[model samples]
Target: MPATPGAFLGGVVVSCAVVGAFEAGARPGGSAWPARARRTELCRARQRAGSGSAEPCNPFIEENELTDVGLGGLMKPLKRLLSALTGPIPVTRSRAIGVSERLSAVTTLTASLEYLNQRKQTQPGGLNHWPTARGVHGRSTPVTRKLLDIISEEKTTLTLHAARAVVSAGMLLPGSSRWRGAGNIFLGATTAALHPRHRYGTDGSDQVSILVQTATGLARFSARPQTQDALMWYVALQANASYFVSGWVKLMGKAWKDATALGGVMRTKTYGHQPIYELTQKYPRVAKYLTHGVLALECFFPVVYLAGGRLARPMIASAATFHLANGLVMGLGRFVTAFTSMHPMVAYTSAPRTHPSVAGRDDRVLQVGAVLLAGAASVAGVVAVQRRMRALEGWPHSRWLTTRHGNQLQYEMSEGDDESLPVLVFVTGLVSTSEHFGWITEKVARDSGYGVVTYARAGYAGSRRRSASSYHLAESVDDLVDLVRGVVPEGRTVVLVGHSLGGELARRAAVALGERLHSIIYLDSSHPGELNRSHQQSEATERIADGMNTLVRSLNVGLGILMAQPDWLEELPANCRTRVFAQYTDARFWAAGRREWAAVEEEFRAFDGKLPVVDSHALVISAQQTIDRDPEQLLMHNEIAEAHRGQGHSVEKVVLEGADHDSLLTGARFATEVGRRIIEFLDQAESHATSRVCVVEEVGQ
Candidate 1:
């Protein structure tokens, strides 16, 4: 009977898994035979040393002896146990030969077409601007530079064109001589080797696909059956090694262990795709689980391939799914086709083979039990560590209010006995937690004797993740509304204070609040037009956020211990400072901040050229230091103020001298003055409202 493609894929997956499991379970030098051989060598050396020769004892053997009693005896049974589990099954040479030709042809042809498509999509000009090419131009010898340029340009063009022609010819004439395919394969491989850097100009995956196609072509053209088998095995081993090593290397990183690295990658233009990026933003736990899943699958890929039979099929299916998802979400078009081409080699190599050992059926059961035990222990350890960390770092003075959608929103409030005083709500800027307003929140509450509110947005510190369906701006506004209404007493108006992107949200809230809105105070607030003008600036911010998240996750403990208390934090109480530092070092805080920044553009567009219409006076406080540093930003601030003034609302514009954007809130020299000005504005607004009420009452009488 002829073998199906599905069966071939299954065989490949099983082979990979078995090989991986074998590698994990049986370390090369740890087996009894190898250990005994080492011991024998050591005894000879000791005898030589006694006869006046100088030789050092094996450190590994010494360490093993110290760690375990009768190390060789203990490992012997375990080694035997693994061998029984991994014992090969019977497969005929006829079956192996039957699949090899078909599988190789399919893999080669698919890879070739994919490579051609990649070249078309990423035009030749793109290769010229790659970092590797630029480096070559700067550092390479004149002759080397010319050779590289020729290889990058002429060779790439000729190889791609030739490969495309061969694929097209093969499709039209399936029985064409193998010599033609071999020639095309040689041309492609030579081109890639000449300037390996150029192959990855647009996507690294393309290089893998091109190389696989060349290898397959060579194997198919080879007259010797042994040579063909060797070539197939080589491709299969390389693929398995790539997955295993990639997974192992990622495991070494603290970012991957904590599952925060994916979030950082998603924030970059190169790797971030909106669908998957937003999915991770909405459900960070999903990203965490996905990180673990990818690592496990890659690490165990060799085991799946080695397992053969039904096991290989599921592994192959899973690998396909992974590549497909990555291709669509990350725009890595070449990965889907490139990696899939290697599947044939995996299938061919994984076919069942007869072994002389008569492994008992009971040994299979023992192998299953051993695998389950190991898997269980790994899961339990991971859970225990995560739970311990979470328990150790509990939130302080945390209060949660359930929104209409049943999501919990966290906020901190300070109130005075005065009911007539307007409630002051402070909204923070992009990537900022409520702790950012600690000093300002304290100063305002202390001096004014009025109620003040500071709350974290969704996915931020102490706040639960928002509903998946909720848009960033609407969700933010809804959460703010809930927090205010839940906390503030009835019949009292509220003042909205916003900083940076928070200021933009305040403007949107002002429009929504209508009669309930008291006034708005903008502190170095983001202008509506700013988003349109700051593409490069936004990219830089994303990069900074990525770096911060990585640093925080990788050194959470070290940073917590080493971080010095900033001068601005001194204004906060001791307990508050500790809480602030804790939040600063958290991966969640950084991830939430990145999501907030990512949504800035969409949030800015939600206004549709409409300004907030508030009956109360509006205050615009621009930092003079920021103005001097960026004249364009100052002009934007001025334009925003003038636009408000033109709208017939009572708008006041003030520039705080010697204060930069952040210094307006944090600097000791300017914070007091900034607070005073804010209080004065609030008091004046209240006075004006009272006078208007008195005049209206007199007219009515």
Candidate 2:
């Protein structure tokens, strides 16, 4: 890269032009993309958003519209549900009936395993530190207690993360905000707690001390917006761009017609099996409308964002939602951060490069060119972070980073709720974590009286991650088995929700807990049957594999830079350790991703099997809108969900009337509606079962 003696000025010029051009495009009079390409992508994005341009959804609907049922109105529903929970847990009773047949002379290993766990009070020193984590982590230290409280301050992770966005307006200068001083306070405090000498613990005390310190530090830091805040808008831009581009490209192709790609995405082993087909079966006429609407949202979110003004707000809001859903379903990064990073907020948060009360500071800008350059640089940094975070999630520098299941697993959980309601243990898929499901979990708990537990399997975010190796499905499965047993406990009525790779795990969880689980939900899930047709042999496989390599490697270089900039790392105490370890230790996950990217680039790898052969009953939530040129793939999503519904085991599918695949999670109506439905399903299932039990006992007695 050649340096421009005064390249800053030149960049400003280009930025000005781009902004102007973009603004012009926002107007109805502006030159539209060759309608063929423009319309195709736009439609696809809309479908992905699940909005068929229908009476443009009333995003202003009150929250009460969805959850405010009068006590009298709710009593009937509650009575019906109580019957369900008391009913002999179907599989449990059956299994219990045959317990004698299964209770052979207890094997020595089984006895030992039982003895070691001892109801989670003690454990083997090295095998699984779950018991230890429970003792050490469950009971937060004073410091940890503080951080946990701070995290608790956030009702949902999305808001917490969104609050971190430091998109200083490009027009303002830095240091203008006293918040920079606040940044100083937080950064100074954390530097000592996270100092490498102390943090890279060589002994057990190091582990205990670091955990305590980190917990306290995070509480202190999270109390501010630093952790979730980190100018998250930077990352949001890249992630949203990826989302919109992916959605639009797919929609622009012939795939848009059938909703095959969108649907298949839900059914891929990567996403798990979405009950898209079930929704189609429930609302055959309206399903496609939902599919196309979602596609269009995905297609043009980028454009809406770049265009700025009123039009951009909805797209931005929806994109934010999309990201939150991604967190919930697939277990990706923070949604609010990912969504705001690239959208209109960039201009305002970045312009003047000044924020009224945000932390962190750099030089102020005078010229528009300088502002654009700064924005551009910031934007680039965001992109760089996105590329690197994947690697960061799989690092081994931290002990929790190495927890592996089937290959890899990510977990997400609701806020402090074990005491609040019955537990709903959610098993997430690849590249997912508790943060993803933050919003959904909150919605479910709020709308329905239930608690949820989700987490990063390992090698994801700051939870447990992979060691030096990449994740594998089998390993991830084992992790799931262990995590569920340890965290959720057995014989509890758990409502399991899985998405993408998580769906498969959800199935596994259902299999493991059978009677313990009251219901299973697949949110745009992946089906094992949808394995890429050629597997390792396909070109798409090669492309995806290759890109992942470059992405992570580049990220490592960025992490290396962070390591060198002790000040910068210190300033980022909330995520410093996470970022550093992810960059340094988990080189392989990114490497594998690179390899996959190289094989297939970003193109979806079609799977032949499409879905796992299973007989378990579950609820599937799918996106049915289409906004693509090639429509078949998007259409297939609904069809597949429908086919599965026919397999018995009560499957209920609902179409997000104005949503697309990507936007549904973020869409105002979808989040409230879908989340509400999930809550209802759990309640009904729990209630219906309990009541059935009462009648039988009464009759027998």
Candidate 3:
């Protein structure tokens, strides 16, 4: 008979499986036949009819039988492998039907009850007004506001319906196979729907636990009587895969491997129990051992399962005990129930099967192919979604302007029609994007009625990189001058506002601008003397910067999801906070920040003893509550103020009490005060300029 398509595929799959097994089993060793012959000779000698021998061996036993010495050892492993590849899969017979049904009922009831309790405590007032209740209202953009509200509603409704369906179906008709299938289907759908909302939840890992349970439930429902064991085995394999992946990922992190992460987590008030926290603190070595033990168990879970029988039972018990301990220590009661529900199924599936062949090898080949295809599709889907999200969030759409050096700079401008008002030109500190001044810029533009502009320097944010030779202070000043001249209206006077290292660039630009400058305001700005003093970069600082750059680039996506808005930004709309956070996680932002740190010493030294002879008014706003505030820094500010006065230019100094350097720009009270001070200075400067023009005209007449 000619071979069919199914047979051909089966032949190909079996060939691949055999080759893979051989590759895995091959190792450097003596001849297999010689080792078997030696073992057989020893066994035969021991089995010989000796005068005082207590143990007996049957003459009918073959030489190969001697190799299977330890508790069904080598032969059992070989049989299990053959079974997995081509033998009949174990099924739940009539006697085993009630076991799965009972387990499913208990899991459904426990999950439903716990979910209801969680909803009462965490969600409050159900789905109605949930977005506003969760403090998600009044977003800066309407689209984001609507999207957040919709997602919240969908998640709440899906979870509620799915939990209710599973509970009702499992409890009312536990014996009914159709109802069991219905419950599993609903639970699986719910798990799929909740995947995207995991990050939004307080316990993301809890959601993952529930997802595993859902998979086990679905596997039980869809599997046929004969193939059910195979499906269950696959689910157990998934559980082991999860543990191994999580354990290995943690091992990659230094803190987790060193046990510090375990200690830190235990000490947290929200997630930690009092007993565990106290115990970990009192006995640090215990914490270290516990951490290492968890890593070992999780990483070796699959090995234990493969060993089967007595070896597997202890490890399985340990996993259950570990979950129970977590429940007690971290108040993760749901995880205990959710994960424990799957344990019995995993245990049952992991046991050695004894059954004759019922299905052809072609079925096994198709099953393996389907699993591989599904896994590949899942990975591709995740990559596609991530790329789509990045595109939708405007990460790729950079606002560009050609600089004097032909480099494109990214920038943002606040819309305003008030040409009469002085144009507020903002320069951000090193490594920061134009969006760093988001809240302050919006407030200033609205309150002061000034056209505001902020731009990312070359190689920062979304801007194109500059030539290596153009990274110095002079090149930066030239870029700033061109940006302001091109963006600002021709007749409008410019008010320069510089924050941190931006102050250095502002001072340099002010000198180059000469008469076009209306006034300069420094908000907790860096002084020339401070820069010259700290010109030589310390190795420690350099190491810290390098670490930050690496971390930001590698974990940018995760950082974007988990970042909380600063306390100062609490009053801004939620969408504004989201936008600011997205910019913070941009790889270009970190790269540019590192460059700024690298060039700062040289840039500062280049401008040593060269202070701009400012004919325009100057205002210095200093933060009083800076943690690293030096006495010399205060003296530098004072000296700069005195020098402006000495030059016969109007100088004003405003000290903000209880405000840190960042808070000076973002804090609600401080930002409002800063805005008021800037308005007052601009008004006075405008008045003086008007008077001087009138006097000059009168003298000429």
The candidate scoring highest on TM-score is: 3
Q: Per-residue CA lDDT of candidate 1, range 597-665, in tens?
A: 656656554446545434555677888876676666766665555544423245677778877777777
Candidate 2 lDDT over residue span 668-695, tens digit each: 4455666777776555545553222110
Candidate 2 displacement at residue 275 in angstroms:
47
lDDT preference between candidates 2 and 3, better one: 3
- Candidates ranked by TM-score: 3, 1, 2
Name the top lDDT candidate.
1
Error of 1 at 353 (Å): 31
lDDT, residue 600, model 1: 69
Candidate 3 lDDT over residue span 1-701, tens digit each: 11223332332343234223322331222113223445656667876746376656543255446455776665766754543333111223321223333333433444444444445433554433364353545543787556555655745655664665466345334254545555655655554443333223324333443554454455456545546555445545666767786676666566677887777787777775567777878898988999899998887776654532324445666776786577556655444444544554454454443211212211252378478968766665564345334422443444567777876776767646677878888888765546556667767777767778787777664567656563666677788898888777788888788888887688778877877787778777776656555433232354446465554545443433334555645644455565555456555556667666667755555655645555666788778864245555666666555555534356777677777778676666677777777777677766664323110001000
